[model samples]
Target chain A: MLFVPGNNPGMLLNADVYGADALILDLEDAVAPAEKDAARVLVRNALSACGYQGCEIIVRINPLGSGYTGEDISAIVPLRPDMLMPTKVSDAGAIREVSRMMAEAERESGLAEGTVGLLPLIETAAGVERAYEIAAADPRVKAIFLGAEDLSSDLQAIRSKPGGEIAYARGRMVMAARAAGVDVYDTPFTDVNDEEGLRQDAELARALGFTGKAVISPRHVEAVNQAFTPGEGEIRYAREVMDAIEEGKRLGRGAVSLRGKMIDKPIVDRALRVLETARALGLGGAEHE
Target chain B: MSKLVEGIAEAVRRSGLKDGMTVSFHHHLRNGDYVLNMVLEEAARQGIRGLTVQASSLFDAHLPLIDHMKSGVVTGLETDYMSGGIGREISRGVLGQPVIFRSHGGRPEAIESGRVHIDVAFIAAPAADPLGNANGVAGPAACGSLGYAMSDAKCADTVVLVTDHIEEYPLIPASIGEEDVDIVARVDSIGDPGGIVSGTTRITRDPVGLAIARYAAQVIEASGLCREGFSFQTGAGGASLAVTQYLKPIMKRLGVTGSFGLGGITGYMVDMLEEGYFRSLLDVQCFDLRAVQSIRDNPRHFEVSATRYAGPHAKSAAVDSLDVVVLGATEIDTDFNVNVHTDSNGYIIGGSGGHSDTAAGAKLAMIVAPLYRARLPIVVDRVLTRSTPGKTVDVLVTQRGIAVNPLRGDLEEKLRAFGLPVVDIHELKERAERVTGKPETVRPGGRVVARVEYRDGSIIDEIRSTEE
Candidate 1:
């Protein structure tokens, strides 16, 4: 995922060139408070006119509690982004409120109900504590994202390096999203210049079971992509595990041995999940053993 | 016509038997240099004693010249600097005289001032005719610039153009014109191009080097210098080139356009220039075939002489106008004193050619290298030799971390504010020593092989040879 400032027409026009699977045309945090209305209008026009070239475009609107939330919904709902992200979401009530507002906007614009999905950004200590409720709140909610910078600030914690801080929040968010049957994403790494740091953080996020990461800079996209993709070695191991499971089934056994390592149903199920994730991420089709 | 001399030996005899005569050579062939040894052998055979030898720079291949210096056939040596075997011999007082070191730009200045007049200048041409018109781009050992030899050919009263591949009467686009030539001769092979390009010139993949490169690029971007028209120059080294690679994607995303790349040209720089990332490439010496081909095909690739490249007095050298210059270091003390001449063992395996000149001139001078090499720590409590003054080197980038010169307090503040991974030079040295045990002290034998002179000709440090 890549974040493009809603007011940046140049970036919006060149979004496909970045090779991002999805783009979040951010209306909050990126824009000045005074220019919120203007940014909303620009984003609406960009979505209406510019061709996204097959990229999933998501419009990150202001929180429902903010003054500009009504205008943001009224303006962007008609344009129809793949998803509408609510920033600093704290609980189920906020998701429910945004869902209700989105439904009303859809009716007013004469668009179909449930057409736009919701992606809530959990940004504070309160939001992390209630991530499960937020993920389970609305059928429209598809993913929950953990924002480390805001959480760190709210908690008054110092993050010196990768894997030291934010590990607990990242882990909790992924677990909550998985339990609620929604996807989870890691927050943006503000240090655009630190490629190694970015790679290490992205790898950690991926290992912790996040679907993807939000990148502040286009330079971060390639590293994030490589981190998420399963290499040939993993694919081969997954195939071996599946083959062992099939042989065990033929022999009326619950487990089997592959290269002297015992393989069970859980291991076979995990291998299938990897193959599915790889296929969904467009890595390659799984070859049966 | 005078009796034709068969080899360099006969040519030296014909030039005249004399003591105290100044002879010069060019470093066009770089480390693969063989013409220096070939000529010195003849000088030794002719019993030419106490003759002063002036070359652009000494390389390991010219180690055989140590015999000539010890036998009194060579005495006063003047060049940019000496390295490897020649430097070791000179440090032992084998020549019985102090060696004079000059900058890449200062060599021309010294010759033009008549301070170091040349009696005979022997130029190794890759391809030349009998009348002495030569071209470096069309020979077996083609090293594409004779810029180092231009001053010698112009100032010397007797110029001998030696060629391995003799072409027709007129070689097109002659680097050294026929009017400056006094004699021409053909030989088997001038030198090997393979040896010239032997040093490490690729991007370093070591974790520390990559870390430093990343931080340096970050510093550049955070300083707001990632905008359009930014100029850069990285020397021929793996770590320096890694900076270029790291900067490429950032520049593309920022939509920043660079004006030009300046240095001893390499193929990597040529690719950047051709990719339209940079508007032009200012080449002083072509390091490989890609640069030579780029110079031949692309008009944007301009070749300038050494004086124009970094000479302090030149109307405004290319290096002086650079935004950044990435350099390599052999040793850097906590005080930031840099030594590109001697290793941790105090063995002279390198020179100070253009290292100091560029550091003092460029806007941001960064030295990127490993903290230790071959279990010898490069970041030390005190440098064994001081080639470039630490005050001029703005930043030291190692695999461990980056250390900005405290003199640039504003830069330090800005870098820290940007969340860069920065550490003090001393801390970096300590970390390096922890990984590779502290280097053993090299005992200095009381003889000086070469004197490292500051840009103003002040003796900063004297290079001593390793005791046998």
Candidate 2:
């Protein structure tokens, strides 16, 4: 995902060309208080005008207490974004409040209930403690996002390049989202110029079992995607695992072994997921084998 | 006994430059050039009128020519390319006669064929001897190759060598020989060294540009032309130059050594030559100081004249041997005819420099540009000006998708088989339109302002005045 300032028409129009899986058009922190109304109108118009083909469009609205959230919800729900990322979400109550406003907007706009999903940003200490509840707040809650900057501030902790400060929050959010059967996204690396650092950070996020990572700059999108994508060696091994399982089934054997390693149910599921991702990304695989 | 003249005015007086005569100059100094303004200002002071100026290219530094045109000191214009400073005036129909725009190859061909005559050609020699032997090296404004001036020197009835640095009696390995120079003059400064060559050339960091570059490199690799002895050319635009960076790793993995790199030489091309990615570089102009240093020190980095570079009538040119070339377009129609001359709003901004020459000669001509720039679709229903005809252009690479010319169905099959994204040209246009809503077409209904001449000296299209 890439974050494009909602007020910038130039970046908003060209956001999909950067090859990001999703675009977060930000009307929260990116827009100044003076430009909130203007950005809201611009983003609402852009969502209606641009198809944003093949990419998920998520509008990051202001927090529920910001006074502008109600208007943001009312204006954007008509355009039917894939999701609305409510910022500064602390607990299940905040997610419910935003969902309530969204339901009202849906009724007014004649859109079916739950047409627009919610991705609550868990950026506070309370949010981290109640992440599971927030993820399972309502059926409208699809995923939870880690906003490390605000979470660190809430903890009164100093952020560092190594990101030891947010390690606990990161782990807790992933486990929480998994328990609730929803996807969790890692926070963006704030340093745009440090490609090596960004790659390492993204790899760390993937290792922590996060589904995807958000990028603040367009240039980081490719690096983050590459970090999340399974390599060719992994794809080849996955293909072999599936092949061994099929061969074992054809022979009526109760167990399957590939190159001296037993292929179990969990291993087979991981392999299937790898092959599915590789196929979706159009990567080369050992299909012939 | 010395052939050195006093100053520019003396050289102009000695060249017998009178009313209605054509004077020529080269643009090796680029935007830093002071010689064009110096010579034209002296001529204007001498009451010269109705003179036609034939130049290799005009930059913003020559904005003084607008005043000359207004005063009737200079009335006609012919050039390979015109930067927007003067191009804007021409677009407003500032001159009585329409400007004649020629390709870099076509300009020399026209001069050689006597189709366009020159009365006096003022050569901006960075270093010259009293006897008028000149070279671009060993001077304050060392702008590597003096290729464009060679044609004018040989064909002009009178040739004047203007220089800031005067060497010994005989300059060894002179780019402009003594026999071709009629008069030599000394100046305080010919051009700013800082402006003569860029400090360094870097690949674009723009994601869109990088994506297009990646796709173009993949196309070149899949074209089966990346084998031994491949030769190629690319423009100096950010996206076009980035193609070289992508091709570097591909060639390394494939163990392919290209024959030569052609056109304006940059530091990247120098690095490629140093690294053995290419055997040599055919330099017409140096785009940066690193290229200037390389051409001066490296024996394999050779300089070629404009006629030898891309002249259509030449027995053989470097462009003819090119395997692939990456170019840029302002807009391209479904038919693939490209427009680099005018912006989408019908304003004169750029002209064809080597766009047509390399496209006609290369095996695979690829255009690298974004699908839409600044809310305007680049793939349009029709190009505002046909700079390079679609028949010669083979591919268009954009961030959205790659479109191969329908004429090259075999190429489409190869690209698709390689798992590259290939879309029809019309579909590409529609894809662009979906993002940027259909723009109101800009039609210039005013009188003709400039005529675009192809490499063969045929009029391909005419740019009209934007003013009503």
Candidate 3:
């Protein structure tokens, strides 16, 4: 859902309506090399002027040392967007560089320190290897997203439909995120018309323990969100399990059974996590996920 | 003995538009019409406050009403349609009171029944005599139909005519005759004639729009309604009008001729009539120049009063037999309640217009819009405002899928059997959400500014004030 091109004002204006929990106004990849300067200016103006129908605003700048990333950061940092996503981030050095520039810009612009967070797109083999270190590099490095297209291209392998080729890298990214105590986003599904494909990919990414999936089209948002969020049956089971486990514990029993399934500690823990995930997904009460 | 006055202020004084009273205006001149703004400005200058405006419709040209609302010169609004300028501000909660929406026929019926009393009525005349006989056809700003203003002239306590041209006494062929007038105030120009009718009424070529139009036609065809002598109505929106275009081929293929095309007549509908698709066009409001000339020239192209069009009080209005109406929506909830009143951000960019009325009366009421606009999902948990009831809404046609209300099991069965992309409302909501993520629910702040009045005059939903 976060694919508003920096050059397109109409896209930027409508970015909120598509309900991308966060909108990444793209300053790189989406803009042509010749139109980079114009796109930067338009994105800057839109950031300062247009109100995003309540979606979290994130601006994805071009890679560091690309000559445009510096300008993009300098132009957008003053507006204090929720986050800045620097594409093709290979190591902690690139993150540190962005952090320094953002700090300098934040100070110069009179914004509070540490107001802007960083979302580094881990695309290279080197970045995937250094995921945990890069995520733990800066306090502002809130989330690490796996750029599957770039990573797959770097690995010189064709992407499998069910994500077999990207599985190792995705698993490593997820573990690294957990180790670093930060969120990790899966790569965006590219085929806009393929809803089933998007849904399967999102479900696979969610199963692999990614926090959220990246979105190329606004159409991909719902699938990713739903895949990441627990559903009604799961929520009901989690609630009942939690309630039963709580009752057993109150009665001084070490374990309990519901529907002939062993209600062990790990199962209880998983149920708690499920309920927590549901609550965080904005699903409230015992009704349903 | 003549009713001609010096200015709007003089006319306001004559009509007794005091603090805390209701005044009315018509939108036949549409976006080009200047009388509403002129009269409201005069009212604001007169230090009038807490006044309600009962307009037949509002256009983008009435942006000045925001200031009037802000300054408390005008607080409430009652209208059938609104075209975004004042609407966006109102949705952001600019008005202290909510704008009541009535149908085209309901507006007049409300006035006549004393449900809504107008202290003064301002008619934007193209030409009016000193004695206050006015007609739209005989002036520089001819808008073709003054149907919306007729009832206001009859029911308002005092009636004021604001026109640019001053004809001699007893203007001939008066659409609004002299007997209803108390005063006439001449202005330099009522408004730009070109700006009166909308320009977006053309059949949309956008493939998404075309796909939706195609599906809507198929739904109508599958509903077992598109036979010979079938009747229909649609709004002046690009997508809605596109349904008119796509339906032509289907109607031609089926060799089915329609009875009449109703509501705000457009050139597209006129073309359909001329092409032998429909027998006649019953226009309450002419939307384009071709329609205007057609009404003036063609015997088959006729002008109908608002009462005869969609009046709830009528024995049977034109909407009663409406086979289908393809309308657009800002949002539609899981329950099938549709909101045309506000955008996804809860900004009032539109009003009910004929949305609820046609839905109530039409055999098939299809809410046609993209599943998601911009990045905002059109299908939601609950609409921001319920302009039309769920039971009245039969089908929702979007580029993504078509949702038939559970109330219409037959519609669902028919659409599914025809191999249409029939999905449940909940499934459509999920389909929309699966792509656009769940939008942060927009909650209007703690104030009720307006109530959506169903065609039966019952409060269907309340629009809350928002500071957005």
Candidate 4:
């Protein structure tokens, strides 16, 4: 996932070219509150002007509590993005309210009732606490993401270097999303200059069970992609595992060994999954899909 | 003091039968490398024992050389890089002494310093005269620049030029001159041109890779280093080339020209030079066809011995003179340490190459990669192995966000000021761990398969045989 400022036409136009599975046109943190209206207009125009190819475009509108939320929804409903990202979602009530507003906006805009889905951003202390409830609130919610900066600020917690302070919240968001049977994504890492740090954080998020992450800069996406991709050694090992399993099955053996390493049906199954995921992401080889 | 012979067997005999002698070959052929096995087969026929094989780099096609290593005909080895077959064998501890690996620049230094004196240098050229004047750009086997063989020809006591095409007397525009040639022999085919171009070294079309390359190019441009007289180095990969291609427009638009470029010079570098992007090219090795022609025709395309490329003690290493270097990776840890040697399964498929030397030498070392490859994370809590120490790696660029090592705090501040997406490395690792599940530790057998040596010749990490 890569974030493009909703107000920046250049960024929004180039978002699909960055290989982000999902492009979040952010109207929340990326854009100043004063530019909220302008950002919505720019985002809506961008969606209407250019086809996003196959990229999942999600417009992250301001919180429902904000006055511009209704306007933002109304402006974007006509353009029809794949999903709407509602920021600072505190509870299930907020999601339900946003879904209804989106429905109303769609109706008024002459669009289909379920034209756009919802991806909630759990930012506040209350949001993290009610993550599971918020994720399960509306069927329209496809994923839930944790916003570390806002959560840290709301909790009055010290923002640790490298985000060690917010590790618990990030993990909780993953568990909540998984329990709710929806994908989870980590928040945008603010320091784009620290490429290694961004990579480390993304790796941590991947390990913590987030399906993907929200990236604030183009530089971060490659590391995020690499952190998620399998290495050549892993692919070779996976192939070996599959080969051994096939041989084992042919010999009526439940398990076998290759290069002295044990290979069972479960191991083969995991290997197949790795290959499948790699192919799905267009990352089976060194080249991008 | 006698003239060398023509056949591989004759060359081996003329070099004198001995239990141990160092023989060297170059990797100008890349995967098309065929000289090593041919020479080893002759040595085996003569019952040569304890032969120390020195190569510029080893590829999968050189796997047949392993039989000689196991048979005690070749008991030692030295090279700048080892990948695929040779890498697996070394990682399995099939050889007696640990293979000594050097950077592309360091290999020549070792030879010149008498640390690794070569007894004989067997060069495989595409075309050569009987007197040993040879060129790689004019034959069916044309692989490219003999940048790597230049050092061996100068430092080795004896030099043998093996070619598939023996041109007329005094082959004009010689890449390796007569002064370095002791003998020239004809072979069926010096190398397969098809194999030379097997790997893609063009710009990446993948959106994520392209974005990282662009951002890296941006960082280079923003650093105020993409101007006239700036020198740069790029790894031999598609994305690195993409970074170069991305920088071309920016450089052209700014009217910023460079004095020189460096690293594994390819056609892309040649094009840049011919187009007046750079005044000169410091080529340590030719990676493709165009570079060979450039080296032959363009006097400005100067060839430098490996010693001058990244030798720690060279007066001024080529890498040391680089403004920026874009590299690839298999895994990078949060501490900023990079692993290009071992894989997630703890098997080896990568080599040291110039990874550490460039990281430690270049003004800006940017590692470009996607966030995830094949479900397994490329950024780990701890890299399976460390080839380039994190201290030397300056910036990490990905499609998601950029992370600058804290050591470059000022640069980080500058990028942040530009409104770039800067994040801490630890945060990135945490996020990855959160999704992938923490990596479980794997116990290895007691035997050590490979030992990763830092540029300073210190052991940084060791890979043990996988426990079954």
DockQ, in order, for the candidates?
0.02, 0.49, 0.02, 0.15
Q: Please give, as one word, the docking class of candidate 4.
A: incorrect
Q: Judged by lDDT against the true structure, how good is candidate 1?
A: 0.80
Model 1: per-residue Cα lDDT at residue A286: 70
Please give the lDDT score for candidate 2: 0.92
Which 10-residue window of candidate 3 chain B scores lowest in summed lDDT?
B198-207
Q: Which stretches of candidate 2 lie over 4 Å from their true place?
A: A107-112, A236-269, A286-288, B418-421, B430-437
What would the DockQ be for model 2?
Answer: 0.49
Lowest summed lDDT window (length 10), candidate 4 chain B? B197-206
All candidates in order of lDDT, best leading:
2, 3, 1, 4
In model 4, the runs with Cα more than 4 Å from the true position are A1-289, B1-4, B198-200
Clash count list over all predictions: 4, 0, 16, 94
| Per-model TM-score versus the true fold | 0.63, 0.93, 0.62, 0.64
Pairs clashing within candidate 2: none
Best DockQ among the predictions, by candidate number: 2
Q: CA lDDT of each candidate?
A: 0.80, 0.92, 0.83, 0.79
DockQ of 4: 0.15
Residue B435 deviation, candidate 3, in Å?
1.5
> Model 4 over residues B1-468: C-alpha lDDT tens digits?
534355777776776646788999998888887788898888898888899988988888899888998889999887767776677777667876766666665677677778788988889988888788887777887765677788788888888888888778788778788888887766677677877753335655555678778888888876667777888888767577788888888889999888888878877888899998999998877777677667877899987766677778777878888889999888898888998877776767777788888889988888987656655556777788788999899888876678899999977887787666787887766544543556775545647766665666677877776533
Tens-digit lDDT string for candidate 1 (A1-289): 9999988765664454445789999899999998898889888877876557568888998877678888888888888888999999988998888889999999998999988899999989999999999999999999998888888998889965574668889889999999999999998888988989998988888889999999988767779988888777887888888877778889998658999988866787778888987887766647775
Report lDDT (Cα) of residue B259, candidate 2.
96
Among incorrect, acceptable, medium and high, the docking class of model 3 is incorrect
Per-residue error at B125 for model 1, in Å?
1.1
Q: Place model 1 in a CAPRI quality band.
A: incorrect
